[model samples]
Target: MTDHAGTAATTLGISTAGLDLEASVALAAEADAAGVHAIWTSELYSMSATVSLAAMATGTRRCRLGSSILYGVGRTPLVLAAEARSLDKLSGGRLVLGLGNGTVRMLRDWHGTDPSAPAARMEELVTVVRKLWRIHEGRVHHDGHFYHVDITPTGDVRPPLRECIPVYLAGVNPRMIEVAGRVADGLVGHPLFTLRYLDEVVRPAITKGAGRMGRRAENIRITTMVIAAVDEDEEQARRDAASQIAFYASVKTYDRALAVAGFAAEARAIREAFARGDLEAMTAAVPDRMIDAIAVAGTPRQVRDALRRYEGTVDHVILYAPTLGLAAPRADRNVRRLVAIATAPRDGAR
Candidate 1:
C-alpha cells in the first residue's frame, strides 16, 4: 500500500452496481488479491447487500467488505443490528455498515413509508441500532418523532464479539452530514461531491456535528464513491459519465447537491434537456465544469490526478465504475480497470 505522510494511505474500493451477484463476489476476491483495501456492495432493486457481502467474505480473506448503502426505512433497527453483527462475525470482524436516508421517491413509492418524517426516523433508527449492538440485555426504547422501538433482548441473544462495527452514514445534504458526524463512525460523502462542496458545505456541517459531541474532525472518516470510467477513448468515457449525470440531474435529491456544488443552473438546464429526449442537448447541457465536479473519467493518469485532489480530505475512495447492469464480461473488465488504476504505483515509487 502507498504511504502518505506517515498515514496509512487511503485505499480503493469498488461499489457493486446491483448487477450479477456471483460476478460481484468473484470481482471482490480479485480486488482483494490485487491489494485493494475494501469492496462495498450496494442495494437498490436487488439482493440484500448484507447477503452479498456475506457471500463475498467467504470468498476472500483480507479485503474488508461493506454495504455501500442500505435504505434505513425498509428494515427495523434490531433486524439491521442483527444482520450487521452476523456479517461482522462472518467476515471475521471486517464489516462496515453503511446507511442512508433513501430518496424521497424510494420511501414514497417502494417502501410505502412517510417521507415527511424520514430524517427523524433515520436518526432514531441509528440510535436504536447502536444501542442494540452495544447492549446485551434490556428493553431498547426511544421517543423520536417517528419509529419508536421497545424490545427486550432474548435470553439466547449474545453481544457481538467485536468491539464496534464501523457505521457509515451516506448523505450529501447539510443536515444529514451533520447527523453523520454526530452519530456515525464515518461519513459516506455523496457521489456528486466536489472539492468546493467538501470544503464549503460538508466540512462545516461535519465540524458542527462533531463539535456538538465534543469530538474532533479527524475522528470521523470521510469517504466518497465517484462515478469513474477509464478507457483509451476518453470521449466515450465522458459520454457514459454524462448519461449518468443527466439521470441524476432529474432526481430532486441530487439537484440539491448540484446546487450546493455551484452548478444548480447547469443542472436545471440538463434536467430540461433530458426531459426532451434531445440526446445532443442533454450531453451539451452537461458542461465541462459539471463533469469535472462529479465524475473522474479519462485516461488512467488523468483519473489519478483528478482523484489526488480529494486525497487528504477523504479517508477512502470507492470507485463507482460504469458496469452496474452490464453483462458479466463487461463488468469484470470495468472492475479490472479500476483495480489496476488503484493499485498502480505513482511516480515509479514502490
Candidate 2:
C-alpha cells in the first residue's frame, strides 16, 4: 500500500537489540543514513537504552530515536521529563518516549521497587511528565497516589519546554492497554505474537479501552515490534527465531502473549525447561507452528510476505533481530540482512 506521498504506507523502524554500546551506536548512524524511519533500543539490565540513544543523537543526522521501552519505576517523573526535554532538544524534536512497567522479577529483585498497581503508576507518570512540560509559572507539583513532589523555583529549574514529545505505552494485557488508550499517544506491541492474536485479542482490547473514553481506536497509533531473520539458510533463520521465542516464553511477564496464541501449556513447559537450565529443551519445545505464527523469517521475499500480515494494523514495524545465544558475527549478519529486507519495496511495486 502506498501513501498519498507515493511512499510505503507503513514506515520501517529498527530495534537495537541489547548489542554492545559501540556496535549499537554504529548501527544507529548506519540506520539513520539508510533512511530508516526510526531506531529503538531496549533497557533490560543491559547498557541503558537512553544513554545509547544519547550517543546516537550526536552521530546521526536523521532517523527519530525511541526507547523500545524504558521501565517506569526507577526514575522520578521530574527526572524523566528533564531527560526527555534535553534529548528532544538535542535531536531537534525527533524523540518518541515509550514507557512500560518493568517485569515484576526485575522491579522487585534487582531494583527493590514496589511492583504493585503498575498501571496506576504508569498513568500517574504520564500525567506528571506532561504537566511538567506544560508548566509556565510556579513549581510543578503533583499529589498523586504514587508520587508527590513540590519543586520550588530554584535557579536550577529549566524553562518550560516547547516541544510536544509523543508518549507510547508498552502493554501486553487488557488493563494496561486501557490505561494506554486513556492517556498515551500510542501503544507499543511486543514481538511475541501471531497476526491472529493481534487482530483478535490486541486490537479489540485497545478498541474497548478507547471506546470507554469515547475515543476512536483508529486515532491511536500502534507500533509493532516483530522478530525477524532474513537469510538464504532458512534453517538458521528458524533456529534463531526458536531460541528467541523460547527465551521470551521463559519470562513470566510474557505468558499472556503465549496464552493468546494458544500456547499457554507450551509456554509453561518452556519456563520449566528454562528453570532447570535446559535451554536446548526450551528451544526444541518451541513448536514450528508457534514460530510460524510469531516470527518473520527465511528468505527476504518470504519475510516481506509474512510482515504484510501487519500492514493495516500497525503504523510502524520495529524490526528486531532475535539471534539470542548465537555467535557475534552471525548475529550481526542476521541483523544486517533483516534490515535490508525490511526496508525494501514490495515486489513489483513501482
lDDT of 1 by residue, 224-299 (tens): 8888877767886777677667666766678767887788888878778767877677667888778888899887
What TM-score would candidate 2 get against the native?
Answer: 0.92
Please state the error at residue 132 of candidate 2 in Å: 0.9
Worst 10-residue stretch by lDDT in candidate 2?
Answer: 1-10
Instruction: Provide the TM-score for each candidate, comma-separated.
Output: 0.91, 0.92
The whole-model C-alpha lDDT of candidate 2 against the native structure comes to 0.80
Across 8-33, the per-residue lDDT of candidate 2 in tens digits comes to: 46667888885888888888888887
Cα deviation of 170, candidate 1, in Å: 0.9
Model 1 residue runs over 4 Å out of place are 1-8, 137-139, 324-331, 347-350
**Which candidate's TM-score is highest?**
2
